[model samples]
Target: MVVVGAGLSGIAAAHYLRSECPQERFVILEGRDAIGGTWDLFRYPGIRSDSDMFTLGYTFRPWTSDAAIADGAAIRDYIRATAREEGVLPQIRFGHRVTSANWDPATARWNVEAEREGQALRLTCRFLFFCSGYYDYEQGYDPAWPGRESFAGRIVHPQHWPADLDYANQQVVVIGSGATAITLLPSLAAKAAHVTMLQRSPSYIIALPARDAIGRALQAVLPRKAAYRLIRWKNILLSSALFQFSRRRPAAMRNWLVRQAQARFGPTVQQRDLQPRYDPWDQRLCIAPDADVFRAVHSGRASIVTEQVARFVPQGVELASGRVLPADLVVTATGLKLKLLGGARITIDGQPLQVTDALSYKGMMLSGLPNLAMAMGYTNASWTLKCELIARQVCRMLNHIRRQGLDVCVPVLDTDAGQTRPALDLSSGYIQRASGELPRQGSRKPWRIYQNYLLDLFSLNLAPLRDGALRFARRGETPR
Candidate 1:
């Protein structure tokens, strides 16, 4: 088996594979020289998990930290610690980026090619697991604005923050209302003379305490393992309920969210910037830990400006509303560009695999794709909540294949059985931007990907492996 990536998903895959299939030989190929993929790469101000650590942490290992929302360094260290303690670190090949993979039906193995230190390398594996996340790492989504070259001030994207860049007592403007923008507001405001969050549209912002009060209290009375399990389930159930409530009663959810925001940021900020045009959960809600962003706004260190950008001038950005915002630095917390399967070229039996033409099977494996699985997380909840479930299901399928003496397994999509829909149901900018590039999901069971945790728990973890859509075959016997 070959696992691509060393990030949270990759680590989870490695941990599960080692525990379930101890006899199987596997290697984790990481493109970067670090163990933590996103956590190690992103080094901007106030980098932390958008989801609580209870769900984000591995199922096998409990998150002992008191912080519900952990910082980038802390998450990175947690991943490294897991790798070291679980003996997966020695199996990792850092700086090895998978370039292409070709599947041979005759051999029932994949000829994987990777680039390491400017040299090409090859390896063969019976099963290919794609743990590489669905985003471009080198470059984030930064659209070209008119007169961009005319701006003399420093412009930095959060994905590529400079090491020695200083903004103390300098005017700064952030150009987005997403999670990154919300996180950056207070962190930048601490040192900068003033920080401005300029957005064309508002986003629902909810205030969550930095520490988990209930979790901490539970730990005091219950055993460590028991407390962890309790908190994990609590978060999972609460998140699931909230998501369902948002869909069932969007107006109520919207009103409740607005009231929460108004209470933290007061009516002025709520009316001017916090109240989004769309209903709650239209896009993923941004979580503000300890109301820091609101505190910054109230303290006059940070302010919100709602307007469209006209263009960049010599010193700063010019608004479409005929107003100019002066700034010594501009941070484009724009977004990420999607790159499925780590942007690797895939060919089966010398035939190129068109990902867009394929339908998603159980949101983990692609249609007509054999012995391959991708760990994609929930859009509504913590990412690892879905990823851990995917790992378990993949392990179960692998074991089933071994027991049945099957050489390969692939999902067969029958168009007549179900209707096709967009891969993701979310209206987020990032998801919509890459909708055409991603695989489609079917309307029926197993084919459709549900955002609800409880629904996915039954569908992904409990469903039988021998579903009608899945085709199994022996070596040298390809299913037609």
Candidate 2:
């Protein structure tokens, strides 16, 4: 088996493959030189976990750190430490970017093609797991404005932050109101003369504590593993409850969230900058640890402007309202361009597999692809929650196939599979932009991609692997 990444998802998959199926041999192919995926790639200021570390970290490993919302460097170290401690570090082949994978039904194997230092590298594996992230690393979603070249100030995208670019005492203006823009405002305000966040619309923002006091107390009284489990579950349940509340009572949730922000910032700031047009959970809520963003605004170090950009002038951004926001540096923290399977092309035999044509079975494997599983995370909760479930399910599938003497297992969707929708349930701009390019999800069991963790825990881990939709067979024989 081959894993296409050394990130959190890949590490989780490797752990399950080693412990759950010790007899199976596996290798991890990493595109970059490091182990951490997103954490390693993004080097911008205030790069931290958007979700709490308790749920984002691996289930097997304990995040003993005091900070629940950890920085990018800490998360990167944690990933490296996990890979090192599990002895999977040596199994990772760095600088190996997988370009294409072809599944041969005759041999029931995937002929993986990759590039290593400008050289072609090929290998065959019975199972192929895609743990790479959903976004295109080579490019982020930097929308073309009217006058990009007219800006005299330095323009930098968060995806490709220049190490040498200094913002000390420099006026900075960050575009977009997503997680990246939220995290950057406070960090940049600390050094920059002034920081301004320009956004087309606002998102729901909730401030949480930087450290987990309850987790610390639990660790002091209980065993390490026990404490970790309790803390993890507490977070999981609380998040799920919040999500349900947001969905069931959108108006109430919106009011409560706005009130919370009003407490952190003044009523004026809350109404002007924090209140979103859409209801809560319409998209993923942005987490502001320790009320850093609120503090930045309250201290008059940073300001938020919700308006349409007319164009980039020589000194700053000219808005549609005829107001110009001056800046010495423009950081576009907009969002990522969604790309499936890390921009790697997937095919069945010689026929191209357009993901948009198939349904995502169990949120792990595709409808027409066999012997392959992808680690796509949830849009509502911590990413690793879904990734971990997918890994454990992959292990179970492998074990079941071996026990049943089966060589291939593919999900077959019938014509009456029922109504279908986009793979992701979010209304975010990035998801909406990739509307017709992504896969679909059915309205029925094992085919619908539930965003709830508890629901997936049962549907993925506890449910029967021999679900009728997942067909199995021996090589050269008709699928059963």
Candidate 3:
């Protein structure tokens, strides 16, 4: 077996592989020299998880920190500690970026090719598991705004933030309306002369308490794992309820969210800058821990501009309305680019297989692909929640194959009167941009991807193995 990343998802996959598939041996391949994945890659100011750490943390390992929204450094340390504790550190091969993977049907093995530095390395495994995230590690999604090359101020993308670039007392402009921009506003305002969040339109932003009072109280009274389990369920239920409410009653949820933000931002904030054109959960909601962003805006340290960028001026950005805002530094807090399989070229029996050409099987395995699984998380909740479920399911499948003397397992895509839908339900800018690249989902069970945790838990975690969608076969025989 082979795991494609050594990040949070990969690490979780490793733990499950070791615990459930004990008879199998596997190796973890990481593209970077570090282990934390997103936590290690992102080095911008106030880099933290949008979701609470309790739910984001692994199911086996309980998160002990009082801070629900943990910083990047702490999260990185936690991942490292988890890996070390689980004995997964030594299995990681750093600087080995997988470039191509070809599965041979005759031998039921995957011939994987990767690059380390300037040299090429190859390996073979029975099963290929891709735990690498969806984001493109090479670069973020930065639009080629006009006059960008003519700008005199320093332009930086948050994905590749400079280590020594200081913004002390310098006016900074962050361009985007997503979570990155929302997080940067409060953090940069602390040191910058003035910070402005320039967005074309508003996004639903909510403030969650950094400290979990109920969790703390529960932990103090109950046993270790028991308390953690209770809090995790509580969070899962609340988050799921909120998402369902937003989808069922968009207007009521929008008004309630606006009122929540207003209560934090005080009476002076304008609705144009706070309320989004779309309903809550249309795109994933941005979180402002402890109302920090609203406090910064209320204190006059940061401001919001709801306008489209026409071009870049010598000193700053020129708006569509001919308004020019001065800035010493420009941080493009634009969203990430979706890169599936870590930009690897996949082939089956020497034939090419693009991700877009296949359908996602239960959001893990792809249709017509043998002995492969991907670790993708939930958009509406903590990413780790869905990733953990995927890891567990992969382990279950591995055990089933070993017990039944099967060599391969693949999900068969079922068509419903030739109808199909996009895999993701979000109407976010990034998702819409990558519509052509992402796969489609089936209309019914074992093919449809329900973002709800409860649904996924029942299907992937507790459901029977023989679902009629996931097919199995021997090495020489074709998957039924």
Candidate 2 regions with alpha-carbon error over 4 angstroms: 267-270
Could you give candidate 1's per-residue lDDT for residues 94-195 as a string of tens digits? 999999999999899999999999999999998999999899998999989898899989999999999999999999999999999999999999999999
Clashing pairs in 3: none
Clashing pairs in 2: none
Instruction: Work out the TM-score per prediction.
Output: 0.98, 0.98, 0.98
- Model 2, total clashes: 0
Candidate 2, lDDT over the whole model: 0.90
Model 1, C-alpha of 434: deviation from truth (Å): 1.4
| Per-residue lDDT of model 3, residues 166-185, tens digit only | 99999999999899998899
Clashes of each: 0, 0, 0
The runs of at least 3 residues in candidate 1 whose Cα sits more than 4 Å from the true structure, single-residue gaps closed, are: 270-272, 415-417
